[model samples]
Target: MKAFITLVFITVTLATYAQTKYSNEFMNIGVDAAALGMSNAVTASTKDVNAGYWNPAGLVNLEDRQLALMHSSYFANIANYDYAAFAMPLDDRSAFGISLIRFAVDDILDTTQLIDDQGNVNYDRISLFSTADYGLTFSYARKLPVQGLNYGVNAKVIRRIIGDFANSWGFGFDAAIQFKTDNNWEFGVMARDITTTFNSWSYDEEAFERVQNAVEGQNQELPETTEITIPKLQLGVAKTYTFHYDYTLRAELDLNMRFAQNNDIISTSFASINPALGFEFGYIDMIYLRGGVGNFQNELQIDNSESLSFQPSFGLGFKYNGIHVDYAFTDIGDQSVALYSNVFSLKLDFSIFR
Candidate 1:
């Protein structure tokens, strides 16, 4: 039974890769508890090391060398995700950042050997393998001549591996801009995979043969080896309000747009747009609370009725002397799927050591 299930899993995974949509999805899962807690609505307001992933243009706001780390588990602990980032000012007008991300499912039982050549069940032959994806990003940001304006770009490399069965390599680029007004209003835009990322895959023939033989006539041939990811755009607006001298509140809204039509809130032949809203409350810039809602979708019910669904997230944060600790209770999918996960992240300023 276990071997059969593993075969089915591999078949489904390969099949999904044939489609262009949602390719390299692990990279979109996001990083940092604070950003995830805000449903990734920080494109216009991010300013720390995490900006290397969110909106590199915001890196211009960094005043000191910074480092960040985060970890989270998904699908009831069946998968794990990890992220790390570092950013520093190159001068008064330019900044540089680098980030790394990994998502993996480990210790999967490779039950191909569960049955001996004599067709007898033998648990002793079972082995373990893992499937993992990795991303490395290099980002650069610079202040423009126009006051309160900045531009940034990212060069990314992608790696994917399925134990000893298959592996792939990919490359992509991203561009972004951020602007701040004297009235405290902020705006930002980001273009992901602006050059259309491409992944080329290679398979181990012997291992693939085992997969094909496991399911008669089902996996008769190798799957498509090339995958493409199109461009995606995000636009954001934000503002901060101060109540008295110690209390503050920040609100942000973002529109995530994809060229192909889908189940998003606003869908058309040309594009689909999903809107996200987030808010943060701070006291003396030390303690914080955050909340957000996003991922709007239209789903068909069992009775053939249509319904709307969304994902909600909340978070808490504390900062003292350049150290920040954040926690978020969030859902990766919509309410219908209910894949909730706990995320934690830490950020530090190198200036603290000096």
Candidate 2:
């Protein structure tokens, strides 16, 4: 019930502000520094610890001990996120993994207006686009007896902070089932951000008081309420096929059930399935190249042609003894070239034991 409410409010807020401001939505874009470089999709067969982010079920592929850390730098010098995960095999059929992800939007300078009813500009103040979010995940995976197939699930708690204000955290869960076919064909299904959250957007008495006084004079009480909603309910099904020559083919279909419209964070989702496809290849285990095209219907020459901007991405990766590094480039489809320029990331993985 709480999850349902959060999504409702987040959606309402987005719909209201969609015409004016751009907000972050599906691409809450994680800090998988490496996977960002390769258009992701490496999780189904990933043997490294970073698998915890892509598909917790992939942890079942970890042979022994591993630890990984990743960081991503986004556009506008805004929020930067870091992710760390540890994984180990519990037995031949099961593995346990723990992951921590932290997000901190860089301090921002915002303008606040102070004016009289007579259209008099009294004064203005500077504020910040502030937010601090963190998520903790506990994941477990078990390999099914048949043909290297595995099933995994992760439960997580997400918390947020903004300008001395924190809202009640929302809970989320991820579940995926993976299957491997002969040669190197694989398939996966995942549900992400199942626990959509909406934050308490109550104005701070200390901070909002300034705006109140600016508009309402001294002791007049204002009668208005503000609330924001977060979108919820997403389901994705993906498939992968690998060649002995080290070439990989990947594709996924993601469906975001938007019960309400959130123009603020445009994606052309409109309660339907969005298609994404990519391929990757490596030469003798040294260098890798990957690329993909994705997005819902939108107005963009490079992608969709109506609602939200489209996304086309590509990535590169390198591997060495017990360590691997990767990177990716993405187009957010924003009209402003600078804002839509690109999204980049880096990932690092190390083996703790043989």
Model 2 lDDT, full chain set: 0.56
Query: Once superposed on the true structure, which residue ranges of model 1 sit more than 4 Å away at CA?
Result: none
Clashing residue pairs, backbone N/CA/C < 3 A, model 1 = none
TM-score per candidate: 0.98, 0.70
lDDT of 2 by residue, 129-177 (tens): 5656677788888888888688888877666554442233545667776
Task: List all candidate RMSDs to the true structure.
Answer: 1.0, 7.8
**Candidate 1 at 322: error in angstroms?**
0.6
User: Candidate 1 — worst ten consecutive residues by lDDT sum?
Assistant: 14-23
RMSD of 2: 7.8
Per lDDT, the best of the predicted structures is 1
How much lDDT does each candidate structure score? 0.92, 0.56
